[model samples]
Target: MRIAPALLAAATLLAGCATTPMARTAGPANVPPGMQYLYGSGEAAALSEQAYNALVDSVRAQLAKGRPATAAILLPAANGTSAPGTCGDKPYAAVFDMDETAVLNLGYEYNDAQTGATYDTARWSRWEASGAEKVAAVPGARRAFVALRAMGVTPIINTNRNAAGAVPTARALAFAGLGDFKHQETLFLKGDADGKSAKDGRRAAIAARWCVLALGGDQLGDFTDALGTTPAARRRSVSSSAYADWWGRRWFVLPNPVYGTGLGSGWDDTFPASTRWTDPGDAASVAQPK
Candidate 1:
């Protein structure tokens, strides 16, 4: 539920740099790189469309194979990790994260970039309540929703948005062309289950009533909280033998460079020491061999 501090710091730095009078009036150049890439670039849209396409295709194949014995959600296991929840005679469904996965918060992000403000829960709650027309569906999300419904699989939204804003959140989804989402049924928000920001509890609640065949989100935590806190640990956790195979099969991820847990990592963590190199032309450094 916490926004990455590193990302906020970076935004603050960018804001600090723009204190010059000329920078105040700058247009897109003033926007952060991540915001530019996520909200403005075609690459982000293509990546989102690719994920939704894969999700629809995978869910179709899964349905063709008949009823699965388990849902895609992870449950607390004896080994301290997580395992898929068992499915009984539950109805079929596909669970998804709402923000940046199915709907793009265009207006809110625009404000973030324009004001260069760090993430604020109070402001976000206001947006959730009254920013219905300021959003748009992520590429292919509308189509994916329709397709999943046509295939007889219910599409459910599992978001960390506050339960107090459930009505407006549903309205926002509908405004974005993602169709209707009933709170506590097709839509599960924060405070609906255990009242914690962690979504596993709500996911379990959904799994109890439906057999989720596919899961989609822009962040790793959207799938399971067991993915660890640090970047390296999360990488290893996700790519571990037990979870590697679920990437494009039972799980789908949309690109979200703007802000999230994925944005936290130092230079050393991002690039290993062995991968470090210096240019031969640099006067103060020795060049490392490729």
Candidate 2:
């Protein structure tokens, strides 16, 4: 999960909105609003539950239609075209991103909040190796796993967590009650395929063996690397007709406001100029009576 420079810049800008003079004086209140909403709010929990429920339903419906002709994964072709992986009697499986999608790294996040530091690769590597006990399964993930297994669908984790920490990563998933994830078999990591952070290669490897019915993650890269880098490009890519209907049908995204590629958007990218509005009154006069 390497944060791009653009995303880092956006995060720094957005941090200003979260940290105010009053917030800085409040001590423990220094936790960013995004972190609070993602890690502490019930709304995020409900959203996770809703996404999992939809995913399960989608899988069930697809299974009812018998074997699929193509996998849910988008495969890039050398001829400048892309298509879903062809399915040929492969076992049914659902691919999911682990961190923030399947489990919450409560311990690492707490430390981060306490220190007010940006993402640190070395620190994250340490957490990956030692933070198993501090993780919790995302809401509804446990139940979703049970339901998927009961329906004869295997749950597979494809995360950007390093392969060197495979043992502890599996432990973290199990600790969070998500069941066992064996390296290279049930769990695929960053160095597992092509040694890149992008997951499309790993996804291709998984799709080659299993008929992927559903894809779940907090970042767009979990599903495909074709999404453009910018905020506007990413939004348009998802909303395009080719993928517009895939949201709740074959792809499920869990909420992750704390951090990710989705966090960095400027004011112009977030709000359209046509929608801008002016108060049309003095602040002192408005505050005098209203």
Candidate 3:
């Protein structure tokens, strides 16, 4: 999450609800400072790099045999829908999210954390508009992007950033060496039509014009209707019988802990002891702080 510098400077730290720590825990009560950023900067990058490379390899193999992959990453795991047939030989395309998936906004995130800023539209707009020279591509993203073109798959960029962000967004992608998508239609910005943030409509529009082979992003919404839902509801979307099967083969997910639904979804109040684990040891043995 990010906010304006002024807001950051004036914001007061709020007190969180006090809770007793669980007994037998192996680590500290609070997350160590900067740990989340470190994961996004280091470990997550490496994993994403591998995933992109694997996707390229898989796509290449399928294309080599003059056969398009039957998988549809954009389709919901629970539905009867399938990848749209090529729209009258329109084209085979691959879709990706811009931030955190195609481009690494680590610099923005780090600066926000260091300066104690919160995520606001103005701040984010400034970052997108002029922060390009600072942004970088996700590892392996450039190579995979290049390969997509070679495989005869048109690369389409779909981002939730508003329409005003199109130019800078393109600049950043190009600056990072992943700028093959030069055409206007290739880049789909948020609010292209009716102003709902849900990407399903835009994705449908793209699918109507092309055969969408794969979809990749850091959030569940990148692939399905998992955005803006409660934590449990989001979990159910991915785990339920309708959508549980196409994890690695169709949908490719990258890790982003910085600012997802959990950052805004308030703590869940319901608790059912029956759903929790039961250890063999006596419950009385563990000390509970008052």
Candidate 4:
């Protein structure tokens, strides 16, 4: 059959639109596990501000007068003691955690979601090899770092990111206007930490040398090693006496709903329909009645 010219044109246009990927719809699961950046950008930004303000207030309060009273040690020493913070004349400090703690590794998760893709070493290497040139500071985080520096407090960025990230990370921080924090040796990566599983060793080291007035990060581990084996342990650690004093007082934590060890095991250990799948009432159904 012969088609009308306008009808043919309309069919072509409709076909093009039909082939396009659908706008992701909301469901019981709107976002997947690895797509926190795509799902939680606002939360991450809010957390960054919280950490920044905590450091600023802690530093200002510490250096106000007589002596450093309240301080959050980044790592405790090997012997379980904190290094005192003193430098000829300078008083206290504030230590920061990189990754979600300081700058959002949002790209890894963000790209995955936007492109409807998954993570792989090859992809991550490309992400890193690109020098993370597009990386940005955790919202207000860099400003907080600079502010602490301005207050005469040492600002240290401790990260788990490998050395390959050093140059790019530094540049990004600089571009974000975070002034230079001397003592070149302080950016801590995984291998740099001592035997202590807890940051005690590092915190102690910093405490021994620098008066850490406050500490900020997304995870509890950044503040103290008290966060234990299980999720419950971690919860307990946060409420424990030693950390009780520091919680929210000398430490500020940013939100990290994307990735962390915090999420309890779900259907993840077995075959699941999707990356973000969670076990339904299946487990409870199998449990014996008490």
For candidate 4, the lDDT comes to 0.56
lDDT of 1 by residue, 207-228 (tens): 8899999999989978987788
Q: For model 4, where is the 10-residue window of minimal lDDT?
A: 1-10
Instruction: Estimate, for each residue in 1-290, the C-alpha lDDT of model 2 and write its tens digit.
Output: 33422132344345456353233233445566667777889999999999999999999999899898988999987888678898899999999999889999899877766655567688888999889999899999999999999999999999988889999999999999999989999999997878878888899899989999999999999888998989899999999987887889999999876678888677888888999765749686567653
What are the lDDT scores of the predictions, listed in order? 0.83, 0.85, 0.64, 0.56
Order candidates by TM-score, high to low: 1, 2, 3, 4
| Candidate that would win on lDDT | 2
RMSD of each: 3.3, 4.0, 7.4, 12.8
Q: In terms of TM-score, how similar is model 3 to the real structure?
A: 0.75
Instruction: Write one digit per residue (lDDT tens) for candidate 4, span 1-290.
Output: 00011121122232232122234442212334323342355654665676677668766766776566435663434686533334344455677776656665555555544454434546655765564545567778767776876776667776544455566656655654665533335565443547433455666566656667777877677776656766656766677765676766677877654445544423433234675534456687557453
For model 4, the superposed segments whose C-alpha errors exceed 4 Å read 1-44, 74-91, 114-126, 181-184, 193-198, 265-290
Instruction: Tell me which of candidates 3 and 4 scores higher on TM-score.
Output: 3
What digit string (tens of lDDT, one per residue) describes model 3 on residues 1-290?
A: 12122222111111223323223333335432333543445676688887787777766765666655353545343466533334445578888888878887766765664544456787888888888888778777888898899878877887887688788888888888987454348888777644657777777777767777777777777776643267667766677655676566556776554555433333352334556554547565344332
TM-score of each: 0.91, 0.90, 0.75, 0.67
Clashing pairs in 2: none
Clashing pairs in 1: none
What's the lDDT for candidate 1? 0.83
